[model samples]
Target: MTVTDGVQRVLAELQRFGIDRQDVIVSTNVRTRLDGLPRSGEREPADSGAAVYWQERTGARRVIAIDHYIKVADNLAAIAATLDAMRSIERHGGARILERAFTGFTALPGATAPSWRDVFGVPPDCHDMAVVRAAYRRRASSAHPDKGGSNDEMATLNAALRDASTELGKPIGGEGS
Candidate 1:
């Protein structure tokens, strides 16, 4: 979806919860425009989208942002339901969508690095890092053309094999692994 559309949908969600004005926090799956990550600024991180809040009343002594149990959840429905209840609780209107989060994977201990190939679901054999590396080294050398293989074949195989090896070195999961 377009960024503006995403923003609108979120705003509608917050309004449905009645947290559309006083004070609110919002977040979403960051896009290329959010951080200027892309040379063209067109890449969006839709895979990661979420938001939470710490709402406050203008002069209420004890501000209750307790609706977090309703929102700040994992998927869209919880957000919608929370917003609906929040709107019901507030009566008129209250907050707005604030910001969007980004798609990121938690770095795990010895997590194999993601391969460009993995985005397409190819797995590299060998769980041990050393073995994987050695296998790649051998495959790349044999695939090289100076030894007599076609340059096209060598280039294709060696590159694919190398890419797979690099991916195997790290863990998968774009984010939140």
Candidate 2:
């Protein structure tokens, strides 16, 4: 199918999930002619991506983005393949949305560091220092050098604990003031 057809299908699918067209954002790199007009069809190469932004009745704005179709040679093929994948997802079950705030060092470009919450395997809303420390200890058991883990792994756990504790305004080894 053509790129336009793929886009239309995507919009229709989102509508089925109660997401309004106004709440969705479509994006793509458009190939242009010498006269500065967008190329009409999928013949040209461009990177295509889109995001559906939505909010629960009393929740923060959240997004489900599909931007990984870069392997396709041209924008048209990329969007077509993406539509097929979305349809497959619908066939099985709808996409599951997870909420997490990408923060601090994790937000930087090319930074592979996991967020504190990710390192501790805790949900974003779990901010109690006691819970974070318990998570740290649980992970530390497997990350400590004596337990067949490398120094780097243990160091990452330590850093994760420090960052999380600081963000929570709690002392690392003592009760909060």
Candidate 3:
């Protein structure tokens, strides 16, 4: 599908959810010449993703975005695929998808920090700060430099503890055993 056609499909899907065209924003990196032609001998950038954002009727802002297109090289084609995914999401009740798109985990390019659960060796849904603290102390005992652990291990443990503390809305500082 052409980029324009993909954009139109996304807008129509948004409209089905009571989102007005004016209230929705569509974004992509594809740019066309004023005469609607690609420049001669010039290749477009390799960015092939798009994002759609709108404010829900409940005053909550939501977004559906895709920045990765596996095995897709052409920008327009990638954008078209991403838009198709967006429409499919909305058609199949996209509340969870929309929420996750807006507030999902983000990592720096080429560098991913370990998740709090992995660092603490806890279950994914472990949210109790007490459990977190206990895990931290237990890990710290083995990770501390004085206990045959390296500075890097201790640092990783401390960083994980701080992340969990903040996520659980607890105070930053805590005694580790």
Candidate 4:
């Protein structure tokens, strides 16, 4: 199956859960360096693919990355596996399990840090401080060292929050009134 087919299958599954396609945001043209690329030979360049983000009506959010070189069958299988895992977590641990799973993965070397909007999982035009703070809390909670998270992850989250605050022109402590 093609990438389009894989995306359609996932979207159709989401629709079965009563999610609108619009609510299931699909982002394309994300170019991540592919592993196992031929380093010393003349070969086709690495794959640049898409990423999908969905926030369930129940507030469970997931991000799935699709490689440009993935086959339709593999993509479909991945979607199926993810759904199964998500359902199991939902059944056993509820939203907390989903939240814990939502800690964004580590970026590969040479990858630039994501923008504040991306870190907050908000639209580029979103400027509401409330929304930014909410996102920051959700992300920071999972990255905090006391919560079994790494120092590096926490540092990144802190940097993102600072950047977000600056972008919104808000004092970190809500002072300067």
Candidate whose TM-score is highest? 2
**Candidate 4 lDDT score at position 122:** 86
Cα lDDT of model 2 by residue, 100-168, tens digit: 233444557897777889999989888799899899899989889999898999988998998897898
Tens-digit lDDT track of model 4 for 1-177: 444555566677667666777777655432222431112212323343445677878887878775534443344446745665666666677778555554443344655688888877989878787787788889888888998888988877887878888988996657431
lDDT of 3 by residue, 1-177 (tens): 455655666666667667887787666555545643232233434765566777878888887666666211234345445556766776787967766764444444655678888998889777788898888899889889999898989878887888888887787555432
Clashing residue pairs in all predictions, respectively, total 27, 0, 0, 0
Say what the RMSD of model 1 is.
19.4
How much is the lDDT of residue 164 in candidate 3? 88
Q: Highest lDDT among the candidates is held by which one?
A: 3
Higher-TM-score candidate among 2 and 3? 2
Stretch of 10 with least lDDT, candidate 2: 96-105
Question: Cα deviation of 24 in candidate 1 (Å)?
Answer: 3.0
Worst 10 residues of 3 by lDDT: 35-44
For each candidate in turn, the TM-score is 0.27, 0.38, 0.37, 0.37
1-177: candidate 1 lDDT, tens digit per residue: 344443445457655544544344444444334432211223444354455453534432222222223222233344555556766655543333211111122244564354534422334454554444455456556556776667765555544455654655543312221
Candidate 2 ranges with C-alpha deviation above 4 Å: 1-108
Candidate 3 colliding pairs: none
Per-residue error for 4 in candidate 1, Å, reads 3.0
